[model samples]
Target: MTFQVARMNEQESAAWLGLVTVCQLLPAALDSQLKQDSGMTHFEFSVLSVLRFAPDHTLRMTALAETTSSTLPRLSHVCSRLEKRGLTDRFPCPEDGRATNVRLTPEGRNALVRAMPGHIDTARRLVVDALTPEQLDALAQVTAVIRGQLDDGRPARGNPFA
Candidate 1:
């Protein structure tokens, strides 16, 4: 099969460039802040935070991967690191021998709690507080549409703010 690529016009090119720039820079900034303040990467913090809010602070590894938008191998690597740090534990799911589950340790929860303030402050400084209320709502709506497109119309799991 062959397809022709539609060339982006100047306005579309500018918008695309802006989006790409934000995508590239935002994670690094967040990662830097989290690393310096809490000794965790943004991905690690996200993993722990998701588990922190999960029922019984546990989730099947597949569910955790979906929640974090991570691949299984990447999640496994992160989980291994977390386990070594005593932040999480991975075990075979009791209901399904072939599946794995991860639970947040008390240390993980404490790390998340400690990380929150700096994370929120950085987010606000970089994105949230920079936008007006109307802009914030519009940003949410725009991103939701784009995310839906990227994810084959599937809504993202769980409360993003949580």
Candidate 2:
């Protein structure tokens, strides 16, 4: 396949650039705040949080990866780091010898307890507080549409460049 530059004017190109910038920048901003204040990267925090909410404070490693939208290798690496920190433990699954389960350690729970309020505050300040009720609803709708399109194996609507 060959690609060619579209005939977008300078203003349209600038807007596209801005969209890409925000997508990259927002996560970095959140991660910086999270690391400085909580000593956890966003991905680490997400993994810990999901485990924290699992039944019996444990989940199959594969299930954890699915919930976190992470690949198995990536999640395994993160789990290894957390294990080294004494925040989690992995054991063979009770019913399936081929599978492993990850559980939050007491220390991990403590860390998450300490970190959640700050994370929630940052999220509220950066996103929730800035949006009106209607904007939030619209944002949800837009994202859901995109997600549904991807899930349905179809091209998304409304954005030609998507």
Candidate 3:
């Protein structure tokens, strides 16, 4: 028996390289912007955004981890930082005494609110405005297809990586 590797064609290689580059650079760029403007990382901003939309601005720790695509330890560390900054609080989950829940505090909400303008501007400058309307639509569809492939049975959302 022989093992063979199928190499990507020119177009496929370009696409793959572009995707990899975007994956590598985009987060760092966004993280840098968020840290400069809001004193938070992109992941932290994501956590606050998730909690802000959650019921009563709260979510069980596990749920938060899933929603944010984080491990429990990472979530716990980020939560601790957020808690220290008065952005969020962790406490016993009311429905389950054994589990914990994190709540977005008023300070957290305000911080998110304050962070939005600069974040949106950065997003526009880096991505949104860089594409035409057609390109944006195409990008969304292409990304959804890629995410669907990567996530398997998981639900889809707007550029979870971003």
Candidate 4:
């Protein structure tokens, strides 16, 4: 089988490049702020934020991986790091002893709460404040379309925001 490939035209190329820049820059900006203010990377913040909202601040490791759109190996590695810092605790899942569960500690919750204001400010400065309300709504709709396509056929994971 063969597939045809073509170069992007001017408008398409501009739109694609803009999307790529957002993908590359946004996370780095978010991470930089989180790391500087909270000593946690954005991914770490994200994981903690998810766990903070989980039932009893606890979830099976597999469930965390799914919720965070993370690979098991990467999630395990991060979980180990969090454990070392006493931000989270990992234990045998009661429902399945062979599986693991992670719970956020009080310290972790404190860190997340402290990080929240700065993170929100960074997001607003970089994105929300940069766009008009109409543009923001349009951006959300467009991204939702793209995200839906990307997540198609996967289990639906709630947004990491509270």
Name the best candidate (by lDDT): 1
What is the per-residue lDDT of model 2 for residues 1-162, given as tens digits with 9 covering 90 to 100? 999977989998896697578689878877887899989888888888888878898989998887776899999999999999989999999999999999999999998889888888888888788999998898778778757866586443222101
The lowest-lDDT stretch of 10 consecutive residues in candidate 2 is 153-162
TM-score of 1: 0.94
lDDT of 4 at 153: 62
lDDT of 4 by residue, 30-56 (tens): 989999999999889989999999999
**Residue pairs that clash (backbone atoms under 3 angstroms), model 3:** none
RMSD of 1: 1.9
Error of 2 at 28 (Å): 0.8
What TM-score does each of the candidates earn?
0.94, 0.81, 0.95, 0.94
Candidate RMSDs in order: 1.9, 5.8, 1.8, 1.6
Of the candidates numbered 1 and 2, which has the greater lDDT value? Answer: 1
| Distance from true location, Cα of 127 in model 2, Å | 1.2
The residue pairs found clashing in candidate 4 are: none
**Candidate 2 lDDT for residue 109:** 91
Alpha carbon lDDT at 18, candidate 2: 71
In model 2, what are the clashing residue pairs, if there are any? none
